[model samples]
Target: MAEPELALDPIFLLGAGRCGSTFQQVRLCETGNVWIWGEHSGVLAGLFRWGGEAANNRQLTKYVYPREPVSSAEEIETLQHDGRGMAWMNGFRRPDLMAAQRALVLELFAKRLPPGKTRWGFKEIRYGPADRVPLNLLRMFPAGRIVHTVRAPFASIESAIVAWELPTVVALVEQNDQAALDALYLKHLDRWNGITGYLLDLQERWPRKVRTSRIEHYEDERRELFAFLSLEAPTGSAGARIFSKADTAGGYPGIARAFAERRERFEARVAANAGRAGYG
Candidate 1:
């Protein structure tokens, strides 16, 4: 009788924007049974502005994170709201999105669930200073698996600026021919600090259920990522190779350099933490 409908296990794909949300999500869906919807960038586009953040998010992605942007704040004095949740224009959210988009997400996940495939996941760019979304997501799906899509900072940011449309910000903050040094430095500082802070925070709170992966090495890492998800191999899919492109013409050379620096710093952090966490 058309087999029983599958019960879905929701997945929340998070991390910085330029970190490979779209391609990763697309690859995850290659299993041919799960529903995939990763083409969203509203959260990052409006991190600096509060005007119509939810509306903007709705437009960019059918899946929404927070009910509003004003609610999410990492540096803004964190207030414990019984039901209120934090939002980030540049990242996922503080405290997580469970209390925010839980209902809608659960509903969608349930409706689009694949038969006999209870596990489901989504990829979203969570790059703002605040990033408790993964924690929030875990709460939502207690048995869910998180694919912490990461990449080298330089390559990641460079790819983000180009593939993900953060070039203008890069130009402004890189003191490129497009913007002044002050603007470039100010934004670059924010970008670097935001990314560094978020990644380190994740490492500190790295949940046992969470699986960390570097997208720059998607060819090698994606196999592990999908395998953990119990997803079929992404053969003939876009994830088979990196979206390699030469850094020619006008681009965020400064941001690219900063990304490289950030990666080095994080690599060290991971190494130190690895020992402490007994990750050999």
Candidate 2:
């Protein structure tokens, strides 16, 4: 008889595209238990490599997202009802590639996992991950953790410019325009902010199950983090290789610096109204 399959549900990392996703992933992968499939997980990988194919419809709402009402364009996305085909095309330009050419990148991480209990998961840079978790995979791993991390918006936006490498319409003659830069900045803000709202909802509803931690504060919470994962606390000797990289990162000092030197009057006004709509 064959051995029973190990469950493959994963704790999720919910954040924007260029916000040190690789850094967080490497940190987690070094833990020796997690199987980190970076960014190329599930049906989304289909869009990145191939053109499109209809997969099963499901909603995944356990990941982070904003708490506003869904718009018509958002409504039409239908990750559950329709599985969002256009989402696939948006990631990939090619449409007629063979399965071999467009195969899914299903990397099962096995650096130091114990046999018969290969605890692992996807390390994806995703915006709509919430659509996949609550609606689908959580059915299996109900205890899965969610880390909704964020970086300073300006830093993320500046990185996005390098990653996208394009001049906006307003910059037809001018290579870089302030308006386009601002627009991209706001877009990332909206995207990650939406993620924040979803995280709030998921945590509120399942406080014990879905916890909150940040890439910015990993160091202060290392031992607590391992306890949360149910792993034995590392001794001084093993600690060197385990948390060396994460320890040196420190925190968002730049963000604090920016917020510090800015106008406080406007901040007080904004904070008062931010939660006026309230949470779900």
TM per prediction: 0.55, 0.53
lDDT minimum window of 10 residues, candidate 1: 79-88
**So what's the TM-score on candidate 1?**
0.55
| 115 Cα displacement, candidate 2 (Å) | 7.4
Please count the clashing residue pairs in each candidate, in the order shown. 9, 13
Task: Please identify model 2 stretches exceeding 4 Å from their true place.
Answer: 41-117, 129-135, 165-176, 233-280
Pairs clashing in candidate 1? Answer: 15-126, 47-89, 72-86, 72-87, 90-128, 91-127, 91-128, 154-259, 173-184
Instruction: Estimate the Cα RMSD of every predicted model relative to the unseen true structure.
Output: 12.9, 13.8
How would you encode candidate 2's per-residue C-alpha lDDT over 1-280 as one tens digit per residue? 9744554446666555565556656666666556555664445433432222322112212111112334456655564464443333232122223232322322333233445336665555554534543323343346666555444443443344434533342242144344554455456455555555565566677665555554444566557756766655444432223222222112434323332333242333223213521211
